[model samples]
Target: MRILVILRQVYEQKSIQWSYEDRKLIYQRNSYNKSDLHALQWTREYKLKADALVDVLILKKEEEASEENKLANFGIQRCFRIPSNGSEKEDAAFISDLLKNESYSLILSGYETEDEHSCALLPLLSYELGIGVLTAVYQLEGKPNGQLTALRKEERGSLQEFTIQLPAAVSVTSHISKLRYHRGRSAPDFTMIEVKRQLSKPEAVRRIEAPEPNIWYADTPSEEIPQLRLLNIMGFASQSNNSNNLQKQTDHLSKAHLYFTAERLVKWLKE
Candidate 1:
């Protein structure tokens, strides 16, 4: 069996900051998405158990030398890099087109991107390829009959097990498996294939920039506003606040309380 694992580099969320003046997000550093790492772990396990040939496809805005060294630490022998257009739909279409000529029996990817928190790529690619896609997959087992069994997470902390045929795609969650690092591994030298097909340019449209909202500060203590209190607990408040007490209070709040607080905040914002 042959498998292809799709990986994407994303900016570290903790290192990102909102540029209020620029009205955009400023990125600091790039890191491998944790869920993609789990998908890679699953690929490694499948290769070991089924003796399958595995290759990785990396989608990024630009190729970097550090990617080769990082993959080497995971003992990946073969990898391919493709330039991403940064649009989820365009990337999906590009990958679907690229996979059409390939002989890969299975495709794997992370459930969602950490930076965008979007889970639309795999499904869109599968739709374009006319193949089935399984989302939130956590466990996979190969069968002797050439089919695969997969366990997926469902609502209310439930797991559903089912079988799927080859030539399908699956988006795995971070809870699937832990990535095992191979230290001191030599990097594999592979030829980089450049994709020549260009996405057709859409007609340019005029864009309008909206005025930035004024920054607001509250005179009331954070404890009086549930939303501000939640933000304080999440380390989004002013640094001068008592973080130790906030952490203690955060630890004491139940999950239900957090959920309700977030829901209320969303409603308040909409209002």
Candidate 2:
């Protein structure tokens, strides 16, 4: 069975900040961070399990071609590169065309990509390919007749296994396997290809910038009114302050407090 594994090089968490303005995604580099751990681990898992052969595909920005190829010496003997168009939707279309042209039994992808394009592609691939998508698969066992069994995390803190039919797409989590130091026999053959983006490029979700109409902020010190502070809701006040005569009686009554009130009502009724 042939497997097509989709991978990507990612900036470490908090390495880049994303902002949007006028249909553009504004990228602000905070620091040079590493790739996503989950993405790396997923790639490493296939390196060990892929017995017959595995084809890897990496979606990377043009500028990051060098940095993203750090995995070349690893399990990837060669990879099909899909130049990113900065649009997840457009990227998925190119990927779908590639998968459809090729005959692959199963398609694998990381649960989340560097910029979360996998969020758009994973499901889109399943729909476009007319297959089922089992996400977060950590372990898998394939059976004859195009049936495969996969293990994934359950919502209740347990592992759940699924039997998915073949011709399926999956988005896997890091729990699948641990990353290794072993590299493939040779440097991976990397091929870059151009994609003609057909869809409108993915626009930034929403832009954040200096306010033209207004700016909404919470707890701004510049505002004249000090923010209200909540305190002592848990009855943390001084014991002396709570030690009034009525308070003392209420505490002493305990279970008898309701009985005292009932008796007073009965007395008033009789009168």
Candidate 3:
């Protein structure tokens, strides 16, 4: 059984980083970067060091796509490029083509790209390709009949297990494992991979520039708190019955009286 690990080549050096001190986001060009760390983590956990046949699908922007070819030491089969269309759909379509021919039994990709408008594309791709998809996968176990069981990490420190047939897609989360390093500097090898460059020339409908950021400060007057609302009387029916079972009526005051007076007695009688 063959496996294809789809990975994105990001600027391992300069990328965005969240900052709690500034209460805003910041970009880190150097120092401990995430993409490289993430890639290395997958390499170690997946055991893709030596005899692993894998392919990396990277999308590069213009002015860098052609020149952005660098060897990732981990066993990567091939690296395909998509034109810098600047749209999520374009990127998805590019990935879809790479996955079209039913090339590999299992495909592993990161949960989200490094782009600002980041979206988990595994669901859409799986729907498009008619393949099973699992997200936040931490542990992958080989099973009989070319099937694999995925141990996924859910919210609140919970984990869920699922079994998927071969030829399925998975969106891997960063927290799944730790990144590893490759000692040698030989160029990565690729397998029998195929990708179509221009699926369709999409015309640009419109382009709008983002507005500049503006920091503003305001001052407001402090006022005393208002007194709590006081009910004239705790109506018997309103207090007894739940809000949902309490029906609304057109005759408002009469309805209230009927509800409080007769309904209350009827409720006790029914009980």
Candidate 4:
């Protein structure tokens, strides 16, 4: 199975210890927390199941060697580093283009990165990809006949067993699977594709690394607190849909009471 794992890096809480020298963004880049273990968990699971060639997608303003090093160390041979401003549309577009010519049996995503960026992207990704998604999924394996098998966490911590066909995405919580530290693994060569550079002519394949920091910094505005929403699933009847049942987040439930449709669900997800 060709698997694409999505990951992100953020400043470690209480670990961002650095002072700016003459307005340069010179904070310790290594201050990001250990979110790599989450990606490692997915890699281990999929590799054990099907020796899957795991690709990775990272949302960032630009590619840096430090970040690529993080993804490439985890047995990943490819990465889609999409430029993002944390909007749902940009997230959809980047993923859509990546899927335009290629398809994968499994797409793994970490539920919440160090800064909870991916948590907001989880539902939006499923709606935009228009594929069967099982959130908080694990114990995933492939059957002999090209079918996928997995488990989900339902309400009250009940484990729900389900199966979906090939070409499905699963959002995994960071702590669900145990992680092991890997060493002596030579850095895997990964092809890096930038979202903005897709339309331009292909550049020569060269080493991926970060350029030296500029003298000044471009400050990104702070993210505003997201407003609460309620979704109603009054008549959610599946049409023999052999799809992976996705679990819901606890606090976002709005106790809405209305008919269910994919359009409405997607609209609500974007909002």
Candidate 5:
């Protein structure tokens, strides 16, 4: 079986700064998405257990030496790099076209990217490739008959089990087991292939100004006596708190009768 894991480069949240004047964010450092790392770890374990071939496709702004070295240390033999166009739709289309000739039993990717927080690419790719996609998968196991059992994490801390056939794609969540380091492992001579495709220019982005802060202030207390002020606010004079007025209001309420007749009550109930 052949498994392909899609990895994306993302900016570290701690290394990002807000440019208030430009109304945009500035990125200082790049790192692998945490969920993608989990997916890679899962793929590695699956490959070891099932003796399947695993490959990684990296979507990055540019090919970096550090990233290549990292992949070599992970012992992946073949690595594919594609320039990211910063548009999910374009990237999905390009990848779908590039993967048309490849025969992979399963494809794995993170459920969502850290920078965009969008799950658009995988679904779009699945649609173009005409394959089923399972999302938010945290645990996966392969069966003897080319079937996979996946445990998906749902909202409110719930798990849903699914049985999927081969030739499917899965998006993994970050809650899976962390990656284990292999010490003293010999670095593999990995093959780095750069895939190039012409992509349309990304649309211009509009900047928006920050909203003004809202503050509430309390009303100043009146100089009058507290009891008198309370009475005035309640639409009652201090002198109108006598028992006679209260009795008159109570009598008015008691004298009020229901206007609905038996026929009307029966009609309302029927309706």
Candidate 6:
């Protein structure tokens, strides 16, 4: 029973940014920031992670001739070099070809690639391979006939243990378990070889042109109004020279009070 683990070198999260141009999320320039993690460290950490699984082997995507030998030192048993045009679809097709000649009991890949491609290959590979795909598997219990039970995570922090049959392909999520470290006895000789990749030229689906921006600015000042000011106690009063007449009017109003006539009260009583 042979297990093949697919490893890829991807850019850090910060080094890439998503832009919503058109209807899809397109990767744009890193006007954002840089990431600290590198592929070497990531692969080294996985050495510990791969150790936890039952009856499984780890491998790198063979690049040059010496890649597999170099990876062997890091405890990788076999390596698969995909073509340069290796999209997820191509990767699935390549795996299918392997299933025809070589016997691989199971294929394992990360739940998502470190780059923009995430979960794109899993379902396709599973469909093509025609086997049960157990994704995000954290723990595994190996059986005699290559059948195993894996504890996989569902939505909302839930777990479901799946009893998977042999000849399966899976995408593992990091949320499933704590990654382990690698402690190997010796490093294997790194050899270099060119593995033929299965890929074709991608078609130009759409052409995009940056639209002109609609930016405008205005320079305007707030309008100010003049306010009236108080002059003096009586200087700003009306220019009426008849002070005696004004006093007479004021005195009449001051002395005027409410006078309820008896005739009005009699009218009210009649009503």
Highest TM-score model number: 5
Cα RMSD of all models vs. native, in order, equals 10.0, 10.7, 12.2, 17.0, 11.3, 21.7
| Candidate 5 residue-wise lDDT at 138 | 78
Whole-structure CA lDDT of model 1: 0.77
* Per-residue alpha-carbon lDDT of candidate 2 for residues 14-72, written as tens digits (9 for 90 to 100): 54444445543345332111223344455455456545355667766555634433555
TM-score for candidate 5, residues paired by index: 0.72
lDDT of 1 by residue, 1-271 (tens): 8888888888777898877688666775788777887888887777667778777888875544346566764435567778765577888888887887888888889999887797988889889988888998978889999998999888566789989998889999987788777677565545445556464443445443444689877554456678877776666675475544554345567888799789879999777
What lDDT does candidate 5 reach at residue 60? 86
Residue 184 of model 5: what lDDT? Answer: 60
The true-versus-predicted C-alpha distance at residue 108 of model 3, in Å, is 0.9
TM-score of each: 0.69, 0.61, 0.57, 0.58, 0.72, 0.52
In model 4, residue pairs whose N, Cα or C atoms come closer than 3 Å (at least 3 residues apart or on different chains), thus clashing, are 230-254
Give one digit per residue, the lDDT tens place, for model 6 in 189-218: 433333565456654365544534887654
Q: What is the lDDT of residue 14 in candidate 2?
A: 55
Please state the error at residue 105 of candidate 2 in Å.
Answer: 0.9
Better of 4 and 5 by TM-score: 5
Return whichever of 2 and 5 wins on lDDT.
5
Clashing pairs in 1: none
lDDT (C-alpha, whole model) for all candidates? 0.77, 0.60, 0.56, 0.59, 0.77, 0.50
lDDT of 5 by residue, 1-271 (tens): 8888889888776788778787777765788777887888887777677777778888887544345555545546578888887788888888888899998888889998886687877878888899999988878889998999999977566789999988988899987657776566455567878788665677758554554578866454463799767765666655555643443222243323233345558888777
Question: Candidate 2: worst 10 consecutive residues by lDDT?
Answer: 223-232
